[model samples]
Target: MTESQPHLLFSFGTLLDRQVQTALFGRTVATTPAALAGYATRPLAITDEAVIATSGQDVHLTLERRLGSTVEGAVLRLTDEELAAADAYEVADYARRQVLLTSGETAWAYLDANPLRSAARIVIVGDSIAYGRCDPQGGWTGHLAAAHIAANETQNRVFNLAVPGSTLADVSAQTPALLPPRHPDTLIVAAGINDSAVPLAAPGDGHDGLAHLTGHLDSLAATARRHNARLVVVGPVWLDETRTGDYEGLRFTTDRALALRTALRAWCADHHIDFLDLWEPLRDQPHLLVDGLHPDAAGHKELHRHLDALG
Candidate 1:
């Protein structure tokens, strides 16, 4: 047999976009609303409205039956090129794994893993989420390491370079210098929340919002490209309703965030960079926040759901 033209990807989040599905997976994808065992989902309050997951060390959600409750998704029939494209978007933060589907079938899905390779180092740049704070087991980074080992059945090294209370400028200032040494295969940059939270004065009085935002992004992107590695930019999550109007904590500067999101999306498109806009996915969920800034266990689970769908 020539081969059954590899056709399937179990997705869970924004990669579930119809347009993206068609573009990367050849024709329309075949999807089954599926649940990943051992994980729970939630919304994030910090950066681009995104979801997170909280899965314990040994707990797995038992699928007694194929629950019909579906989260919108499609499983695509993909080619190596298509798979490569999808990998560019996902593999940085996750490793592809074989998953048991609702129908008792199996499909290749991207499972979270430590972003590391003996030959290729992975450097994650973002905020507290990247730092794996609030999560005693080391947040997603720790989860990422476990997932990677489970999927690859091999060891891969990664560094959690996320600095708490640091802004995009701070990361930008630091990343380029380290690239020569780390030589990462993937550079994940999660910006916006902090930037929006701490806005710089209007640029010398003449720059527009778009210009200001893009200017900063341009610098980040240029640095990423110079490193010759894949750059994944995670937009900030939405602000909590309770803290929306207040600038004290976790509340986003709505105006600044919108500007940053638009500009970054455009930048991703123009530069062929991978962008995951998480804000819209978790906007409706008000209870995801554990505090004004971080997401609860439930909130983190949902974020992983979104990442799974990124394929």
Candidate 2:
């Protein structure tokens, strides 16, 4: 039999119940017994009583992080559209985050980003784009900081440590210093354009040693996990020039950003990390960029919207 192409979902609640499943989805689904490590279940009384039967009980099951504890559940295969429906069904009380299964694979599970309004910080790291090298100046990082603070999240801290002209290697090197002992809620990473300059990479088959690019990114993901931060990788955006600024003996073709973006999507998917495709979002929108390099004020505003939508 051919294997189904479906995203993995770890369900510990009513979404798994046979009756409830049929009521919402109009059919039953195949599910394998699964358990989530580092989590436990809590019963939350629904505000509206009409949801009792559909939710599988008077109180719905919610997940809580508890090291060494495992939440027994089922792993179901779902298509992209079904997953979106599931998301809509799971409204306000829950937020989805990647969960590592006992089988050494990763899947999406609803977990709060900022539970109970406690202190949460987000670290922004990247290149000139993130550093706000635009005509008007104030970048998306500043906009995001304001949004987070305005939401009144407890002890909200948005640290923008992106440096201009930095590559993936540079960000990886400085990341450790910028991280605090408490860890961060999110780590926004935007890079690759500068690294594509070729001369910045090691000696290899003319492609600036592209072999190690993925490895560098993987290492950075590990770093983010170590700090208990959710990794949000932003792919390279479109460039106006035919080629990147010359770096010694090398000048990367501007169109190559699209190829990097395509590879990045797969990379992020495999690593179960959040990725923002800046290239496509700003592809047809030329006015958003200043000199076809940095984002204008309106562009930064749009960037802020995309990151917010990432939630």
Candidate 3:
């Protein structure tokens, strides 16, 4: 729609933030709280950052009728100039499309487009952090979503398929059955911390440390290439230093976390995948975390900055 087209822009998550809205969309657009249907939002833990998700994890994704339960959000009505500016901001990851409102009428708006629908799907597959745990905003999922929303005002659907405590074996087990037959436009994998926590001496270990991590990452890259999706490998967030419980009968420390990050980065660079060293900026910011495991409010803010840097 043209800037003067009297458009309705649907906003969720950080875009819901008044300050963030004013900063990005300008003051001319009128925003009314609104929601979309068939989805619930959750947080992903990756340092302290604001990210959210509508799918994946233990959260039951509600697949109601196209006119089912509504997600509350702001309906931004903007002048042509404001809309144009908003479009520029959102052209990275989202696109404008008409959606069936709860009333069964089509309202022109923006939504995530399935990469397969146009180019290829870019999938984010990982564990609790990738699924968003601490920030309650789905961590990078929220960042990716907001950025996607801003980057691709033309509409591109991004999918996050991560589960808490998910092991490399879990992904391997599910890939054949759950993954789409085709590759995605991009594939991001954030995992291995929980798996590494398992004591190496344990019998019947679920993941084999570097070997497992390397294998799984390789598999992910192969799958992405098969589907023609850009592959990105994200490093794990550090453990909550305050919470020291026996993980697989072993102790965890910052050194261990840093080692993991190093390994993952090496693998990504070696494999020629897009790597986001999410840990470097915030790994030292332990105070930004919640319960030593997830990112606190400050952490989420820092994460947003990192994501912005990637852009």
Who wins the lDDT comparison? 2
Clashes of each: 33, 0, 61
Q: Is candidate 2 or candidate 3 better by lDDT?
A: 2
Model 2 poorest ten-residue lDDT run: 111-120
Better of 2 and 3 by TM-score: 2
Candidate 1 local lDDT, 1-311, one digit each (tens): 57547746767654566665555555555555654432222231222121112111122111111112333344656777777777765523455544445455555565443223211345787777667667776665666656544654433445668887767777777888877676554677875566665433432445333455566667776676565445677777665645555434334555667777877788777765567777765676778765545666666667756665554
Query: What tens digits encode model 2's per-residue C-alpha lDDT throughout 1-311?
Result: 97658888889888898776677667788999888765667776666554664665667778754445688989878877778777766746676767668876677787653332222467789998888777354587788778777776565677778888888888888787778753565678887777766664554556553445687788788777655556778888766663235545655556556667776788887765666777655666768877666778888888777766755
What is the lDDT, from 0 to 100, of the residue 105 in candidate 3?
A: 34
TM-score of 2: 0.64
Model 3 bad stretches (over 4 Å): 1-121, 181-183, 200-208, 240-242, 247-251
Evaluate candidate 2 by giving its C-alpha RMSD to the native, one decimal.
6.9
Error of 1 at 114 (Å): 16
For candidate 2, the per-residue lDDT at 29 reads 83
Better of 1 and 2 by lDDT: 2
List, residue by residue over 1-311, the lDDT tens digit for candidate 3: 64345666666645455665566555434566665554333332222122222111221211111112356666776666666665554433444544434444334454342222232235677887777777666676766666665655544456778888787667656654445642344566777776566463663655446556777777766665444344566776656666745654655566667777888888766654556767766776668777666676567667667766653
**Candidates' C-alpha lDDT:** 0.57, 0.71, 0.57
TM-score for each prediction?
A: 0.54, 0.64, 0.55
